[model samples]
Target: MNSSDGGTATPAASGAPRSGPRASYPAEQSAGSRRRWFVGLSVLVVVVGVALAWLGYTKFATPDVAGEATAYEILNPSTVSVQLTVTRKDPSEPAVCVVRGRSKDGDETGRREILIPGGTQTQIGMRTEVTTSKPPVIGEVFGCTMNVPPYLTQPAT
Candidate 1:
Protein backbone atom coordinates (compact mmCIF):
# COMPACT_ATOMS: atom_id res chain seq x y z
CA MET A 1 0.00 0.00 0.00
CA ASN A 2 1.28 3.42 -0.92
CA SER A 3 0.62 6.36 1.36
CA SER A 4 -0.01 8.71 -1.58
CA ASP A 5 -2.49 6.42 -3.45
CA GLY A 6 -3.99 4.82 -0.32
CA GLY A 7 -4.44 1.41 -2.06
CA THR A 8 -2.74 -2.04 -2.02
CA ALA A 9 -0.03 -2.20 -4.67
CA THR A 10 -0.02 -5.10 -7.11
CA PRO A 11 3.34 -6.75 -8.00
CA ALA A 12 3.18 -5.17 -11.48
CA ALA A 13 2.60 -1.74 -9.98
CA SER A 14 5.33 -2.35 -7.34
CA GLY A 15 7.88 -3.25 -10.09
CA ALA A 16 8.91 -6.54 -8.47
CA PRO A 17 8.74 -10.24 -9.34
CA ARG A 18 5.96 -12.26 -7.65
CA SER A 19 6.96 -13.54 -4.17
CA GLY A 20 5.99 -17.00 -2.71
CA PRO A 21 4.43 -20.00 -4.49
CA ARG A 22 4.01 -20.05 -8.31
CA ALA A 23 7.19 -17.95 -8.70
CA SER A 24 9.69 -18.88 -11.44
CA TYR A 25 12.74 -20.77 -10.13
CA PRO A 26 16.20 -19.71 -11.35
CA ALA A 27 18.93 -21.92 -12.89
CA GLU A 28 16.62 -24.85 -13.61
CA GLN A 29 18.32 -27.65 -15.54
CA SER A 30 16.84 -29.20 -18.69
CA ALA A 31 15.93 -32.88 -18.62
CA GLY A 32 18.93 -33.78 -20.74
CA SER A 33 21.45 -32.09 -18.44
CA ARG A 34 19.89 -33.70 -15.38
CA ARG A 35 20.07 -37.17 -16.95
CA ARG A 36 23.69 -36.67 -17.99
CA TRP A 37 24.66 -35.58 -14.50
CA PHE A 38 22.96 -38.63 -13.00
CA VAL A 39 24.73 -41.00 -15.40
CA GLY A 40 28.11 -39.37 -14.76
CA LEU A 41 27.74 -39.70 -10.98
CA SER A 42 26.59 -43.31 -11.27
CA VAL A 43 29.57 -44.24 -13.42
CA LEU A 44 31.94 -42.54 -11.01
CA VAL A 45 30.43 -44.44 -8.06
CA VAL A 46 30.72 -47.76 -9.90
CA VAL A 47 34.32 -47.18 -10.85
CA VAL A 48 35.30 -46.23 -7.32
CA GLY A 49 33.42 -49.18 -5.85
CA VAL A 50 35.16 -51.60 -8.21
CA ALA A 51 38.58 -50.20 -7.43
CA LEU A 52 37.98 -50.44 -3.70
CA ALA A 53 36.68 -53.99 -3.98
CA TRP A 54 39.72 -55.08 -5.96
CA LEU A 55 42.07 -53.56 -3.40
CA GLY A 56 40.29 -55.33 -0.54
CA TYR A 57 40.33 -58.66 -2.36
CA THR A 58 44.04 -58.37 -3.07
CA LYS A 59 44.69 -57.85 0.63
CA PHE A 60 42.61 -60.74 1.98
CA ALA A 61 42.89 -63.28 -0.83
CA THR A 62 45.24 -66.25 -0.74
CA PRO A 63 48.76 -64.86 -0.76
CA ASP A 64 51.87 -66.16 -2.45
CA VAL A 65 53.57 -66.54 0.94
CA ALA A 66 52.00 -67.59 4.23
CA GLY A 67 53.26 -68.15 7.76
CA GLU A 68 51.75 -69.77 10.82
CA ALA A 69 52.80 -69.91 14.44
CA THR A 70 52.25 -73.50 15.39
CA ALA A 71 53.61 -73.51 18.91
CA TYR A 72 55.35 -71.35 21.52
CA GLU A 73 57.38 -71.79 24.68
CA ILE A 74 58.26 -69.33 27.39
CA LEU A 75 62.03 -69.64 27.56
CA ASN A 76 62.46 -66.80 30.05
CA PRO A 77 60.71 -63.82 31.61
CA SER A 78 61.30 -61.73 28.50
CA THR A 79 61.88 -64.34 25.84
CA VAL A 80 59.68 -66.69 23.87
CA SER A 81 60.51 -69.48 21.47
CA VAL A 82 58.09 -69.76 18.57
CA GLN A 83 57.72 -72.58 16.08
CA LEU A 84 56.83 -71.09 12.74
CA THR A 85 55.58 -72.87 9.63
CA VAL A 86 56.04 -71.11 6.31
CA THR A 87 54.33 -72.11 3.09
CA ARG A 88 54.85 -70.63 -0.35
CA LYS A 89 52.83 -71.06 -3.50
CA ASP A 90 56.14 -71.30 -5.36
CA PRO A 91 58.71 -73.02 -3.22
CA SER A 92 61.44 -71.62 -5.46
CA GLU A 93 60.62 -68.10 -4.35
CA PRO A 94 62.32 -66.97 -1.15
CA ALA A 95 60.16 -65.34 1.51
CA VAL A 96 60.47 -63.53 4.83
CA CYS A 97 58.11 -63.87 7.78
CA VAL A 98 57.48 -61.77 10.86
CA VAL A 99 56.75 -63.37 14.25
CA ARG A 100 55.41 -61.69 17.34
CA GLY A 101 54.84 -62.44 21.01
CA ARG A 102 51.76 -61.31 22.90
CA SER A 103 51.24 -61.11 26.61
CA LYS A 104 48.25 -62.63 28.43
CA ASP A 105 46.53 -59.27 28.11
CA GLY A 106 46.76 -59.49 24.31
CA ASP A 107 49.39 -56.79 24.07
CA GLU A 108 52.21 -57.29 21.60
CA THR A 109 55.42 -57.60 23.56
CA GLY A 110 57.98 -58.52 20.94
CA ARG A 111 58.46 -58.92 17.20
CA ARG A 112 61.08 -60.49 14.95
CA GLU A 113 61.57 -61.03 11.24
CA ILE A 114 63.17 -64.19 9.90
CA LEU A 115 64.19 -65.20 6.42
CA ILE A 116 63.07 -68.39 4.66
CA PRO A 117 65.33 -69.44 1.85
CA GLY A 118 63.85 -70.86 -1.33
CA GLY A 119 63.82 -74.64 -1.38
CA THR A 120 62.22 -77.57 -3.19
CA GLN A 121 59.77 -78.09 -0.36
CA THR A 122 56.57 -76.05 -0.33
CA GLN A 123 56.42 -75.86 3.46
CA ILE A 124 59.05 -75.73 6.20
CA GLY A 125 59.12 -75.32 9.96
CA MET A 126 61.58 -73.31 12.03
CA ARG A 127 61.93 -72.37 15.67
CA THR A 128 63.16 -68.89 16.56
CA GLU A 129 63.47 -66.93 19.80
CA VAL A 130 61.80 -63.53 20.22
CA THR A 131 63.00 -61.24 22.96
CA THR A 132 60.08 -59.47 24.52
CA SER A 133 59.64 -56.38 26.65
CA LYS A 134 57.64 -58.49 29.11
CA PRO A 135 56.68 -62.11 29.59
CA PRO A 136 54.64 -63.45 26.69
CA VAL A 137 51.99 -66.13 26.76
CA ILE A 138 51.16 -66.40 23.08
CA GLY A 139 52.94 -66.24 19.78
CA GLU A 140 51.67 -65.10 16.39
CA VAL A 141 52.82 -65.04 12.79
CA PHE A 142 52.18 -61.54 11.52
CA GLY A 143 52.69 -62.07 7.77
CA CYS A 144 55.09 -63.26 5.11
CA THR A 145 56.21 -61.94 1.76
CA MET A 146 58.71 -62.67 -0.99
CA ASN A 147 60.03 -59.15 -0.69
CA VAL A 148 63.00 -59.84 1.58
CA PRO A 149 64.63 -56.64 2.87
CA PRO A 150 68.16 -55.88 1.71
CA TYR A 151 69.42 -56.00 5.27
CA LEU A 152 68.21 -59.56 5.56
CA THR A 153 69.77 -60.47 2.22
CA GLN A 154 73.20 -59.23 3.36
CA PRO A 155 75.50 -61.89 4.73
CA ALA A 156 76.39 -61.85 8.37
CA THR A 157 79.27 -59.60 9.43
Candidate 2:
Protein backbone atom coordinates (compact mmCIF):
# COMPACT_ATOMS: atom_id res chain seq x y z
CA MET A 1 0.00 0.00 0.00
CA ASN A 2 1.55 3.30 -1.10
CA SER A 3 1.10 6.00 1.62
CA SER A 4 0.40 8.88 -0.81
CA ASP A 5 -2.61 11.14 -1.77
CA GLY A 6 -2.98 12.21 1.95
CA GLY A 7 -3.91 8.61 2.88
CA THR A 8 -7.42 9.05 1.39
CA ALA A 9 -7.73 5.91 -0.63
CA THR A 10 -9.83 5.85 -3.77
CA PRO A 11 -12.52 3.21 -3.61
CA ALA A 12 -12.01 2.16 -7.24
CA ALA A 13 -8.29 1.49 -6.61
CA SER A 14 -8.05 0.54 -2.87
CA GLY A 15 -11.58 -0.87 -2.37
CA ALA A 16 -12.26 1.66 0.46
CA PRO A 17 -15.88 2.20 1.57
CA ARG A 18 -17.24 5.55 0.23
CA SER A 19 -20.63 6.61 -1.06
CA GLY A 20 -20.80 10.43 -1.68
CA PRO A 21 -18.61 13.50 -2.19
CA ARG A 22 -15.56 13.83 0.09
CA ALA A 23 -15.78 16.32 2.96
CA SER A 24 -12.92 18.05 4.74
CA TYR A 25 -14.75 17.99 8.09
CA PRO A 26 -16.59 15.22 9.94
CA ALA A 27 -19.97 14.27 8.45
CA GLU A 28 -21.91 15.01 11.64
CA GLN A 29 -20.29 18.47 12.10
CA SER A 30 -20.97 19.50 8.51
CA ALA A 31 -24.59 18.36 8.69
CA GLY A 32 -25.07 20.28 11.95
CA SER A 33 -23.61 23.47 10.41
CA ARG A 34 -25.94 23.18 7.44
CA ARG A 35 -28.92 22.70 9.73
CA ARG A 36 -27.97 25.80 11.77
CA TRP A 37 -27.66 27.88 8.61
CA PHE A 38 -31.06 26.69 7.40
CA VAL A 39 -32.70 27.56 10.73
CA GLY A 40 -31.13 31.03 10.76
CA LEU A 41 -32.32 31.73 7.23
CA SER A 42 -35.84 30.62 8.10
CA VAL A 43 -35.95 32.90 11.13
CA LEU A 44 -34.73 35.87 9.10
CA VAL A 45 -37.38 35.26 6.48
CA VAL A 46 -40.14 35.10 9.10
CA VAL A 47 -39.02 38.31 10.77
CA VAL A 48 -38.94 40.18 7.48
CA GLY A 49 -42.37 38.90 6.50
CA VAL A 50 -43.89 40.05 9.80
CA ALA A 51 -42.31 43.49 9.51
CA LEU A 52 -43.70 44.00 6.03
CA ALA A 53 -47.18 42.94 7.15
CA TRP A 54 -47.15 45.41 10.03
CA LEU A 55 -46.00 48.25 7.78
CA GLY A 56 -48.74 47.54 5.27
CA TYR A 57 -51.40 47.46 7.97
CA THR A 58 -50.37 50.81 9.36
CA LYS A 59 -50.08 52.59 6.01
CA PHE A 60 -52.80 51.09 3.80
CA ALA A 61 -55.33 49.38 6.04
CA THR A 62 -56.47 52.44 8.00
CA PRO A 63 -59.28 54.88 7.29
CA ASP A 64 -58.73 58.54 6.38
CA VAL A 65 -61.02 61.59 6.75
CA ALA A 66 -60.15 64.88 5.09
CA GLY A 67 -61.65 68.25 4.16
CA GLU A 68 -60.86 70.90 1.58
CA ALA A 69 -61.99 74.46 0.93
CA THR A 70 -63.30 74.63 -2.60
CA ALA A 71 -63.99 78.33 -3.04
CA TYR A 72 -64.23 81.61 -1.14
CA GLU A 73 -65.59 85.08 -1.83
CA ILE A 74 -65.38 88.33 0.06
CA LEU A 75 -68.98 89.40 0.50
CA ASN A 76 -68.13 92.56 2.45
CA PRO A 77 -65.36 94.16 4.50
CA SER A 78 -66.20 92.02 7.57
CA THR A 79 -67.95 89.10 5.93
CA VAL A 80 -66.59 86.28 3.78
CA SER A 81 -68.42 83.47 2.09
CA VAL A 82 -66.80 80.04 1.81
CA GLN A 83 -67.61 76.78 0.09
CA LEU A 84 -66.03 73.59 1.38
CA THR A 85 -66.19 69.82 0.87
CA VAL A 86 -65.66 67.16 3.47
CA THR A 87 -64.76 63.58 2.54
CA ARG A 88 -64.79 60.56 4.80
CA LYS A 89 -64.72 56.81 4.51
CA ASP A 90 -67.90 56.44 6.59
CA PRO A 91 -70.38 59.03 5.52
CA SER A 92 -72.78 58.27 8.38
CA GLU A 93 -70.40 59.81 10.88
CA PRO A 94 -71.08 63.45 11.67
CA ALA A 95 -68.30 65.97 11.19
CA VAL A 96 -67.42 69.43 12.48
CA CYS A 97 -65.17 71.76 10.54
CA VAL A 98 -63.39 74.91 11.62
CA VAL A 99 -63.50 77.83 9.23
CA ARG A 100 -61.34 80.90 9.51
CA GLY A 101 -60.96 84.31 7.99
CA ARG A 102 -57.63 86.11 7.72
CA SER A 103 -57.08 89.81 7.26
CA LYS A 104 -54.62 91.51 4.92
CA ASP A 105 -52.10 91.64 7.79
CA GLY A 106 -52.27 87.81 8.22
CA ASP A 107 -54.22 88.13 11.51
CA GLU A 108 -57.08 85.73 12.13
CA THR A 109 -60.16 87.92 11.96
CA GLY A 110 -62.86 85.29 12.52
CA ARG A 111 -63.22 81.59 13.28
CA ARG A 112 -66.32 79.46 13.26
CA GLU A 113 -67.08 75.80 13.81
CA ILE A 114 -69.62 74.51 11.33
CA LEU A 115 -71.62 71.34 11.95
CA ILE A 116 -72.00 68.85 9.11
CA PRO A 117 -74.99 66.57 9.48
CA GLY A 118 -74.40 62.88 8.99
CA GLY A 119 -76.03 61.10 6.07
CA THR A 120 -75.42 58.45 3.41
CA GLN A 121 -73.14 60.71 1.42
CA THR A 122 -69.39 60.23 1.43
CA GLN A 123 -68.71 63.73 0.16
CA ILE A 124 -70.50 66.64 1.80
CA GLY A 125 -70.56 70.06 0.21
CA MET A 126 -71.36 73.08 2.35
CA ARG A 127 -71.53 76.86 2.05
CA THR A 128 -71.39 79.32 4.91
CA GLU A 129 -70.77 83.00 5.67
CA VAL A 130 -68.00 83.88 8.11
CA THR A 131 -68.18 87.18 10.01
CA THR A 132 -65.05 88.96 11.11
CA SER A 133 -64.15 92.04 13.17
CA LYS A 134 -61.84 93.46 10.52
CA PRO A 135 -61.72 93.31 6.74
CA PRO A 136 -60.86 89.75 5.72
CA VAL A 137 -58.60 89.02 2.78
CA ILE A 138 -59.21 85.31 2.64
CA GLY A 139 -61.34 82.56 4.09
CA GLU A 140 -60.41 78.89 4.52
CA VAL A 141 -61.45 75.64 6.14
CA PHE A 142 -58.84 74.58 8.67
CA GLY A 143 -59.88 70.95 9.20
CA CYS A 144 -62.71 68.59 10.09
CA THR A 145 -63.43 66.18 12.93
CA MET A 146 -65.69 63.15 12.81
CA ASN A 147 -67.64 62.46 15.96
CA VAL A 148 -70.89 61.13 17.33
CA PRO A 149 -73.64 63.66 17.95
CA PRO A 150 -74.13 64.99 21.48
CA TYR A 151 -77.80 64.08 21.28
CA LEU A 152 -76.84 60.46 21.01
CA THR A 153 -74.77 60.62 24.20
CA GLN A 154 -77.44 61.95 26.53
CA PRO A 155 -79.62 59.51 28.45
CA ALA A 156 -83.36 59.52 27.74
CA THR A 157 -85.12 61.96 30.03
TM-score of each: 0.65, 0.58
**What TM-score does model 2 achieve against the real structure?**
0.58
Question: Which residue runs does candidate 2 get wrong by more than 4 Å?
Answer: 1-63, 148-157
Highest TM-score: give the candidate number. 1
Q: Where does model 1 exceed 4 Å of error? A: 1-23, 27-30, 76-78, 103-110
lDDT of each: 0.87, 0.81
1-157 in candidate 1: lDDT tens per residue?
5423434347545766544433434647899999999999999999999999999999888889889989989998899999989989999888999999999888999999999998999999999999999889987898999999989989989
* Tens digit per residue, CA lDDT, model 2, 1-157: 2223334555534766444344343546678889999999999999999999999999887345677899999999999999999888888777788899999999999988778777899988999999999999999998777764575445659
Candidate 1 at 156: error in angstroms? 1.9
